[model samples]
Target chain A: MSRVLMKGNEAMALAAIKGGCDAFFGYPITPQNEIPEYLSEHMAKEDRVFVQAESEVAAINMVYGAGGAGARVLTSSSSPGIALKQEGISYLAGSEVPCVIINVMRGGPGLGGIQPSQADYNQITRGGGNGDYHLLSYAPENLQEAVDLIKQSFDKADAYRNPVMIAVDGLLGQMMEPVDLERTPDSKQRERKEWATDGDAGRRGKANTIVSLHLDPNKLEEHNLALKEKYDRMVENEQRYERLETEDAELVFIAYGSTARIARSAVESLREEGYKVGMIRPITLWPFPENAFKKLPDTVHTLLTLEMSLGQMHQDVKIVNQGRYHLDLYARTGGVVPEPEEFIEKAKAILKKEDAA
Target chain B: MNSDTVYRPKQGLTDREFHYCPGCTHGIIHKLVGEVLTEQGLIGEAIGVASVGCSVLNYVYFDCDMQQAAHGRAPAVATGIKRVRENHAVFTYQGDGDLASIGLAEAVHAAHRGENITVIFVNNAIYGMTGGQMAPTTLIGQKTTTSPFGREKEGTGEPLRVSELLATVPGAAYLERVSVHDPKHVRKAKKALEKAFDTQMKGKGFSLVEFISTCPVNWGIQPRESLDWAVENMIPYYPLGVFKDPEKEEEDD
Candidate 1:
């Protein structure tokens, strides 16, 4: 495993390659352009499939086809582009196709700036596409964790027969960090997908068909329930997060992705000043790691959610906190990232407001 | 069961009833596809990508492996399926609205890339599923739900001649437009399907065959009249001929 400094987008592209991804189809979008550029250069040399699709809509549709045909495929886009991909993403979810998708999120409700933002938290984690479906969502806090999660996401997609989304802030994509390019897991090489359309050569008389259109209401509900059961299994088996200094701490911080990384520096300073501060950094945002919130020590009295969005993930935090602790939100938006000192000020202000009330 | 099968339905087509509206010619095209695949010995390996519109559930009808693509995205889906499983014969069955409208770019690009696949595009002149509406290939002056006052040339543009449009792409190896109105034309349509699949098997490049189809229910005409309408209206406007066939050209050379 060679250690090399790499941008998060390039690291993600290499991580997918090492993880045995068969194809990469995507369009060039800001903050994630490096992913397609890197894949284009290496994938062509490696003789793998790399297509810069005509549009995000086309790219995701290509992903749906490759994924349906039982090939490991990946696509990446920024927030606005990801919005364009939602319809295809929904189709993939509806068809139960396994694939990996990345959204190096930039600021957006519409045509927002091309900078790091957590604004897409709701969009990615909630399955931006139509229908009742969910993506195996991961929000890694650093470049290393992003690489690890991206490599594992392909396996998760294949295992669960669903799309997996790695929603990282644009900063993590542009930031350089040392990564081990050889960390590909050989054990996770998938078997032949029986449900995939990989040709019926020597298989059986009936061809494997992948379709999502359940015209009858009864059958549609049955399909939705089956999908819900699969998601429930993920909730039990796949929830992951990191907890820091929760033991005997009165104030706890809940954050993820880039915000969680920034929260670490703020938590350190608060602890050095003799304050009982802790952190809960969620790795899996869809499952929300509610168990981690449930396992918090009794010393935690107030929970503060720090995010780069307009407090989108804060809603999930509220759901998990369940009124046991005072929940508050400290957020920035439209590509503005909060500094460590700024977070400290916000945390102090929250705790101070609680003290007065 | 037949000990020595002679007249059993083609193994390429499944036993499921087609969901096409009564008098629609999608069933004929589907049967032609099945016959062609069986004759080419590609029944077991052909992967069909079904587009949205009326034929969305073609995944259930084709005995081969099938995928249902989103509206207008079947060409892109077929490209994906073909790239990953190169040995399999991949084809897309799409309707006029699905092909000439929202999915135009995918069709053009796939043909340009010379993707080894077959496209059985059925131009029935109107959207059948969502009720009769103005399709991109809808004839000017055709009245529908969207164009209740009749589709005017100043507003909706001319009926798209899709076969002619795709023939211009450099990577397309074979392109043809046929009709399925009568027994004679039905036989010819099946032959065109065989040639299209054969083109893919030869690793020739992109191949497409547009069928001048009929939509009786949506066209406000009887099944018999729809056949006459195709001959009188669609055939004249859309025409019926080989727009481009490199294999035929090479033979002439």
Candidate 2:
């Protein structure tokens, strides 16, 4: 495969085109502006549609319209832009339209900062929109993963008839890493005309209505129930997590996205210092690896959960643990990323406390 | 003569019935939109965005891909649907309250950006869905639930002329205002709807056709009398005409 050093955001934009995405609709926001800018230049070459919407709301709605027409479409933004798109995302989720939404997350809690942060774990996993719907969220750690995840997002969205989000922190968007452009998946095999609104010629007898409305209470209930069943199936099939040195470990370090990379470094240092510390990184935030935590033995006395936010995923870790063991949460917010040395120090203190107790 | 079958409403709408009050113009507008979709053979390839108002249940009435947006957010949602599915005809059926009030920003931006979609703005001068309230297009000195002592130009300000305001936006391709008070007006309004949809199909960008409708129950008048009042009072404040034609402007440009 031809290797090329590329920024994560640029890789994602190229991957979307390689994945046969027909349109790109987005508004400019920091750390993710490269995505739209790249599409503006490259989409015309591929005869694809690229629209720089007046606002985030308009961009996301354009994605919804394009997705409804059965075209592989995408939209990208940072925290503030993602906030503006929440209503549109909710409607897209409710309508069961397939599309890709890239949130190269920045510091937030209302215009906090533009630095990279994984503070949107709760927002992305537990429905950022207004309805009782779940979007398939993929957390990418590097430029390669960013490209691969965007390519896979289309298939996952179409397979489930739902919106798929590639939640990358601003670090992944800005960081340059070597990516194999030759290994990009070709999505030409996917038949779009079967369900897309690409003119009505071959299928004359059947009338297709792509609506989410059911006036009859019973029919609406049935529709919601079917969606729930689909979600349950996804929970069973799509739960993914990475384990590093879980075997013969006293403590397990839990993290994801960029924080997980930092955790890996800390784990490596702690192992060199003769501490039995391992790490568990969740790739899919939704349909979270609830079983992974349960698989750990009673010997694993302490679980350290690290994130860029204040203990958002720690709540899920505690819920999964069900009070079998206590969990320690460490976080740094407002665009500050915790250093690996700080995590190592924390791990050392927890181990000393265990020994003292 | 086979007159009985001739006047029956098209089969696109189900017989489950609507919650709109007797003589409400929503049913008539719904019938008109459905008929256009049927006549153009665009039913399967059309997606309708329903706005929050008396006609929020437009999803139930229109036999096509229907989506409901928050208040006046239908244009934004329709923009999304149209961009992704370029071949599908996308339209937003919105009320004056939904369009002129909270969703004003979305409407203006969509028009300014020239999104290739159709907007069917139903201006009844009052918020019929959320009880009678002062709407953006409410006539000055016209009474409603909010303006109990009659709309005061000094207090509530003047009614908004949506077509005129939109006509000023450079991206708008076609902007027309029509009423549905009489049979003649109804025919003309249908033609306007067709032209707006045609503009989108030709990829000519944004097109909006505002239908000055009636809310008889909220206005405290009979359906026929409400029509007369709308023609007399509303038409003067919000005149009926094509405010902007992109083709004509292009020749001038």
Query: Under CAPRI classification, how is model 1 graded?
Result: medium
Which prediction has the highest TM-score against the true structure?
1
Tell me which residue pairs clash in candidate 1.
Answer: none
Which residue pairs does candidate 2 place in steric collision?
A61-B80, A62-B80, A64-B80, A65-B80, A65-B81, A65-B82, A65-B84, A66-B84, A66-B85, A69-B85
How many angstroms is residue A133 displaced in model 2 relative to the true structure, after the best TM-score fit?
A: 1.8
A1-357: candidate 2 lDDT, tens digit per residue: 888999888998999888778888899999899999999999988888888887888788777766766678899999888988998888778788889999999998898799988888888888888757888888876777778777778888999989988898998899888998656575656875455434342254333445555669898888888888988988899887888998878889999999999999999999998999998888888888876775776568889999999998898898888887768988988788889999999999999999999
Alpha carbon lDDT of each predicted model = 0.88, 0.83
Global CA lDDT computed for model 1: 0.88
lDDT of candidate 2? 0.83
Question: Each model's DockQ?
Answer: 0.71, 0.44
